[model samples]
Target: MEGTAKSLIEQTSESILNYIITNNLTTGDKLPNEYKLAEEVNVGRSTLREAVRALVSRNILEVRQGSGTYVSENTGIVDDPLGFSFVKDTLKLTEDLFEIRYLLEPRVAALAATNATDEQIEELDKIRLEIEERIGAFSDEHIEKDIEFHKLVSEMSGNVAMSNLVSIINQSISRYYDYYTSNRIKDETIVSHREIMDAIKSRDPILAEDVMRIHIVTNRRSLSQNKKNNLKKE
Candidate 1:
């Protein structure tokens, strides 16, 4: 009897998750009332409540005082599922991240060149212009814009799976950027970004891929050198 009850709870939880996914519910989307949800999932109120409690514990759901439960804004991969935080070698982790970016982003840029809509291409151009205008301002906003530009390119690739993977990698890179202390924005980087935008505008997949590769590789080298210098000073 206990095993059967547990199974029902698990199934109820899964059904709720599926309902959210099927309905295209995003972060902050309100869920149906408990009674309605229980009815829809063909589960008892107790079972449905237990399932929702579990999801809330997992950071997948949140219950507001009077507003009811809602999906979490950062639902997927809430914790370090792989124990990346336990890894002592920060340098290697950073390197691995860049290596992953090197493998994925050039291909993403190529696809974006071929598949991106006119509006998306125009958006990319706008981001590039923003970076150019902020080159000497020494504001971190440009760095953020750079990150957004890459993410936008990934989305423009029209591959949802690839875009999700790039977002994960880009998040890791952004975390690293918080620790990397550099105020100087290179002229080469600005020029390279412009070239990449031009290639995408021309719908030249090959050129776009090549330019992206050079851009990522250049940044990777800079980070590696910075790591080495920091280690020497320490």
Candidate 2:
């Protein structure tokens, strides 16, 4: 009995997904009223509600009290999809996170130089200036905009997976900055960001790649040194 009930719920979930696809529903689009949706999907109201709750947990749907259910912003990607917060060693996590960034981001920057649309390039410039405005303050906005700058560069590459992966790593990177951000890197990032923008703006893929590589290496060095200094005090 339990097995059959669970299968039904799973089948209903698939039906809901199919309905979303068939009707061209997108993020922020409201699902039909429960009675209508259940009928359309050929499921009972209780089954449809159960399926919707399951999707909500997977970050695929959201239910707003009194408003109705809608598709979530990131579709189905959870904020901590990799479970990075479980790691106890902050420094080790930082090192590994940067390793992934180092592997993927330079090539992404190279592609952005060749592939970015004019509007995306302009948006990149806007994010860079937003970072510049928040510089020296070193507040959350500054760090956030800095992350946005990198994430935008990935999107400019015109690779959806690359963009999403960068965003995933960015969640962990944001935490690392909360503790380890240093003055040197803060200044260096502003300079490096401008250099990256200029290289991409000029459509120089090789220079953009080289510049991004330097930026990543420089950040690893700064954070490693900061970690060492903190350890010495302890």
Model number with the top lDDT: 2
Q: For model 1, which pairs clash?
A: none
Off by over 4 Å in 1: 1-9, 22-29, 44-50, 53-65, 71-83, 130-136, 177-180, 184-189
TM-score of each predicted structure versus truth: 0.79, 0.91
- Off by more than 4 A, model 2: 1-5, 176-180
Tally clashes: model 1: 0
* Candidate 2 CA-lDDT value: 0.87
Q: Compared with the true structure, what per-residue lDDT tens digits does model 1 show for residues 29-139?
A: 999998899998888898899999978877789999888999987685455544567767777887888999999999999999999999999998899888877766766
lDDT of 1: 0.82
- The clash numbers for all candidates, in the given order, read 0, 0
* Least accurate 10 contiguous residues by lDDT in model 1: 176-185
- C-alpha displacement of 3 in model 1, angstroms? 12
lDDT of 2 by residue, 109-209 (tens): 99999999999989999999888878855566787787788889999999988877898887688785553355677788889999999999999999999
